[model samples]
Target chain A: MTLATPPVGEPRHRRGSPRGTGAFDRSRRRLYLPFVVPALVLYLAFVIGPTLAALWISFHRWDGVSDMRWNGLDNYSALFDDPTFRTALANTLIILVVAGAAIFAISFVLTMIVREMRGRSFIRSVLFFPHIVSAIVLSIVWGFIFEHNGTVNTILSTVFGTEPIPWLNADNLFLMILIGTVWISTGLYVTIILAAVDRIPRYFYEEALLAGANAYQRLRFVTLPLSWDVISVAAIFWTISSLKIFEFIYAFGGTTNDMPPPAVWNSALFVYGESFGGRSPSYLFGYASASAILMLVLFTALIVVLRRLLRRDSIEF
Target chain B: MQMRYRRRRVRAAALTLTVTLGLFGAACSADDSGGGSAQQFTYWSMWQEKEPQAKVLAKALADFEKESGIKVKVEWQGRDNVTKLLAALRTDDVPDLIDQQYFTVSNAIVKNDQFKDLSDVHDMEIPGESKTVRQVIPEKYDQFTTTANGAQFLIPYEVIGYSIWYDAKTLPDVADNPPKTWQEFADVLARSKASGRNPIALDGDIAGYAEFWTATALSRTLGPGGFYKLVSDKQASGWNNPGVRNALAAIASLAKQKYFIPGYDSSKFPAIQTKWAQNQADFLYMGSWAPTETGTLAAPGFKYRSFNFPTFGSDESLPASVIGFAVPKSADHAEAAQKFIAHFLHKERLSKISSEANNLTPRSDVEVPEQLEDVNELLQEKKLSKITDGVLGDFSDFDKKVFQPLNLQLMTGKITPDEFIDQITTGQRDFWAGHRS
Candidate 1:
């Protein structure tokens, strides 16, 4: 009787057809090539073309202005041997894995709590606010909160009589940045997971409860399974976004004309520091390009591996 | 029915493509229409549009336009001028005149042989002045004028001298009698610390700013000539120089005494500077630009003052550099650019630059603003030293790799004086080895 049932008496293809389904399908198939050509041309011209160009440039020694000289593999070898690049790579990975894990775990906890709260919508809106704000503005606010003579220090001195903490020191800067990253990213994941969790029927939770399943058990047996697909997609998204984090760290220089100290540099900062950065730019185009390509390759591999690991069959209600 | 639907869909797609292609073509044609008349000359200034220098230069350019009956298109590109210039040099859209810091041009762009010879501008009359451009500027700036190939590449305009700045309202005694000896300076710092205050407020976020303390100490201890020799000489044992050790030890002692303000190593740029302006800190080591740079954030009645870093029984030579204009080799209007430079150097225009821009004009005859009287006096005294004592002058890489990192560690008390020197010398030796190979 339903539209999906395709009426009981008609053949499968013709049942739903108001205007000759077979002929319409054939015509649509004929239109696909012409319809797709423009988009494919654009994609090739903008995305794939520049990517291949970057790969070609990565093999040369160029200052961006002068003639490019071919020096195959030398840039790659130099990158691995460079201590600054190593630090940048390590920082980027730490941001990707460590900050990412914290974001997911915290977001999951927040989702669980917000799901049962009376003012759930209000809480979700508040949590989502930081994500929508500019990263540069967020970084500036974060800096002021943690500065020595800033608000936190003022509160500590007056209320607790505690000495000020050096929250943004070289030893502590990357850690502070990681914590800020977690704060900013948790909201988006929470919203995503909440949306996935909301799709589950109320009867599923009621049945779990009647069967003597506790809240944690229900989360494991009901909520998590239903949301697994969305969680996997979110994981891949986080992996890519975390690698491109530059503005949040770059703004820490706070009116400085030069790039931030190398201690907190990520791959993006590394690429910039090598070319068209600093008071006097080094402009090592080939070196910067090689680093960029390395990041692309690493991110591509990570995304693929993540998809494989987080893959799950959809659960139908 | 199928044929009608197919025809409609194909028409819609064709319409969308046509619209997109039309928009793109419009954009391309709009960009292509930017070429101006042949009588126009373009200038790209390195100052932001709102900066005092940019305003003064715009007015001078306007005056030149009126006098010469030539149209000049000025672009305020700020710090992006260097990058844009490099890119534009490869194309026909290159600017006729580009303003840049002398050190930046000499260090980054000069070796590329892109700048035209500016020797003719040296003898050009300074508009209505009886003096030629060369006669007004001191011979000391000649160091920046001539490129490695012995061709003049820059016309020095706005000069900057670096020194230790302090809030006069807070430290009237130190301001009255700025310490002239290292021992005296240390005593002042010790006294300031003993009175429950930090002596120095450093924005250690900028490693180069932190390096100033060590550079000044080395300059004083080794003298300018000795400091240059130590930096330029390729000897593996450059760090073994007694002056280098003494300078590091002196910086370490300040750290040992906890003379820097709390969280000095971790504080962001302008935060420490802001605190210094607020009279919360005793002294700040910065360039002459500090006053104008921090003017908006300074507390009420804040009197900004500066003095040369105290010496160790040697002549004081404060760090100095010049920011100026140069014509590119491919410029189509080199004569117009030269005329602009000559007009810019006129005594009347230079005086306005000094007064309105809060800049130290290179011309000795122009009177500096009251805020920069101290810097002008030092310049008149001929006490300005090359930046970093001219150390790392020939080796620009050493500033980023060797000097800044080592200086930051030293400032943070993360590394000892001995460790600082060892790391620097090792870095220098490795750098030379790589270059030689």
Candidate 2:
């Protein structure tokens, strides 16, 4: 496998090769196996290896300590009936669709506004700052902003003479989490969409304006179509990242140092809660693995569907 | 010819380097796997290195090594101690001694049969003391310390329990003569409200804390082990018990009357608990760790005091949780680990748990810390039960999915007692139906 590796590793070395010469192309091809083989080996060992192992584990009843007992399909059946897992799966989908929609909608608007605004780069940087901050820090700050006597309620009570709202109560907690997630996530997507928007030559907007294009027309025809590829990639990125969001919601149990209520759990939190998290670690490795594998299959299919829907022909400027 | 030869040599070198690096990476990933010598058993504690409990235990570990002339290797793994140990269980590198809350050990290690039965340790005489290990820790603690089949998998060290914690300076009337029944408890809340103070300070965001109201009330109504039985029934028939409805109604009344601090349902955990410590509210149903957790933020003159969960009907079962040491069955230095357990159980050594860590120890002879005096007296009473009657450990996923959410709804007045019963009944039924193999 190593012997036939490609010269994809050293483009500079291959750049000097004559374009149509068989000898140079053959030599470059000779390096292919060695370069690609190592990465393929590492990927197999790290990523594909554990994933297969998890698939195998999903069929058994293992506490992660004792010998694994084969219990074919029981864990999967149990997951379907497990209300917490259902809630988690539903929460994951809600974040993917609802929060995803809000983030893109707001980010596109922000991109359009900032594209024409003064100091656009500075505004973009200011907006992108939250993405760079740790989710733990962001969630804590969010908790402080929404707690009953928190910043929002304090202002409401003091200025508006209103009762302090229970923004973090069970009825409203997941909503607050979704809004915070959108607030933190919008900045990164906006920056991506904006960077793509900026790459479009300014003449496109000018030409559209001369043709009597309204703001929406300029956005639909000139901005979005030009940035469609980045938006598609960003959508996929958000889908995966949203599923992996455990730390932010987990930190809501702050200072008390327990997991947040199961009512608010997403798929990642469900996996952790069943396996290694919580005061009494369930260590239901087999069951947790089953849930994890189910989520992986569901999301993989969703991504495929998304790619198919978002596929667009590239426009040459 | 020269160019081809050089290229071949370069390829060979690259291949060699890749194989060498791969082998090196594989070697680095392997844990340092071995059980240490008998003279130097390893220890992993559930306390962080800087925690007061770790400090006290560190001193004891150091002293034990000096006296026994056996080196002690200790790691302060904090709350993840058991987790790390579980990951290391199949490896030869498993720690010789580890400690965590009893049920945590019970649910994780004991159930797996990875733990060594410590029944012999009960008979081992304490270092420089006449009493055996069994004599030092009271028999009453066996409710928490012993497993269902009577296997003592862990040796007792610290005792943790839950109660209605309050500031003595703020409610000296209740502190002087604490309420014993549910009606008296209601009167106390009403009187506190009449005096213009929020009667209960709860961090409702912590569903576990919120569920304490139902857990204790159910325990009082259904008698010892009643709550666990109710939640764990295979048929889910126990949820229909009149006692369960009564327990729900009692807490529902508190929610309807608005006894909790304003917006308690939305306050982040430890925030409302901190306010309770600051004497902003009158009472908090919490664990014995309340004082230590809130100590730095407490009001200047805040006096920590507690009373048992006000009884419903005639039962007076008190909830107790234990934290102590256990040895793995695979431990190479099992004898040495057992020796350390006996050494730590000595009154002189265990008293430091109270004095330095400000925690309650299982040793009846050890002088209880002032902060834990109320809790200690409560544990000493005749009737005792395990935390949440051990439901939270045995059926933890059920607790997380079924019990906590519904109980929270009941506590927040989002649902009535009847709805709580109805929802929990279906939830438990579905849980067992799916779980039955």
TM-score for candidate 1, residues paired by index: 0.91
Instruction: State in Å the error of residue B291, model 1.
Output: 2.2
**Could you list the CA RMSD of all candidates, in the order they appear?**
4.3, 4.9
Candidate 2 lDDT by residue in tens digits, A1-317: 01122344444334554664777577767877777777888899889999999999999999887888999999999898887899999999999999999999999999989999999889999999988899889989888998988999889988999988888888888998898889889999999999999999898899899999999999998888878888899999999998888778888643435788888899999999889888777788999999999999999999999999998765545
* lDDT over C-alpha atoms for residue B342 of model 2: 91
User: What would you estimate as the lDDT of candidate 1?
Assistant: 0.81
Off by over 4 Å in 1: A1-23, A26-38, A253-256, B1-38, B168-172, B223-236, B296-302, B313-315, B389-398, B427-437
Q: In candidate 1, what are the lDDT values of residues B21-55, reduced to their tens digit?
A: 65785675453314556566889899888988888
TM-score of chain A of 2: 0.91
What stretches of model 2 exceed 4 Å from their correct place? A1-23, A253-256, B1-17, B29-31, B34-36
Q: Candidate 2 — which pairs collide?
A: A4-A33, A5-A31, A5-A32, A5-A33, A5-A34, A6-A31, A6-A32, A6-A33
Listed models, DockQ each? 0.34, 0.51
lDDT of 2 at B165: 93
The DockQ assigned to candidate 1 is 0.34
Candidate 2 residue lDDT tens string, B255-355: 89999898788887778988888888999988888888999999998889999998888887678788989898898898998998999888888998888
lDDT of 1 at A206: 86
